[model samples]
Target: MSIISSTSHATSNTATLSQRLTAAIGASILGACLVYFAGFSHIEAVHNAAHDTRHSAAFPCH
Candidate 1:
């Protein structure tokens, strides 16, 4: 009775804490990846575009 309920209560609390911690870590990792990929992809596109537009005299890519 008392012992069983207390054990269950403790387990529930621990589970709740674990859920919150997992959600926080997942959100943080997702946000970081989104920011990094967005920034890197945009920068890469700009760099490639610039390289493609270089004048023939100054170009070594040909």
Candidate 2:
């Protein structure tokens, strides 16, 4: 395998399911919090999402 392919395969074949899930969930929550607290940083993109357009929950997004 090429270096990139081998590195990708190794990374994809990690040992623990829960560990990976925890990492992914942690990253997502961190990202969401950053976006939530970034103060107008992503307003345009949020405004462009379908949920923000049609089914917005009672958050300050709209």
Model 2, 15-35: lDDT tens digits are 599998999999999988865
lDDT of each: 0.67, 0.65
Best by TM-score: 1
- Report the lDDT tens digits of candidate 1 across residue range 1-62: 35554434444434588899999999999999865565456688765665565544486754
**Model 2 error, position 50 (Å):** 20
How large is the C-alpha RMSD of every model relative to the true structure?
A: 13.6, 10.2
Cα lDDT over the full model 2: 0.65
Clashes of each: 0, 0
What is candidate 1's TM-score against the reference? 0.43
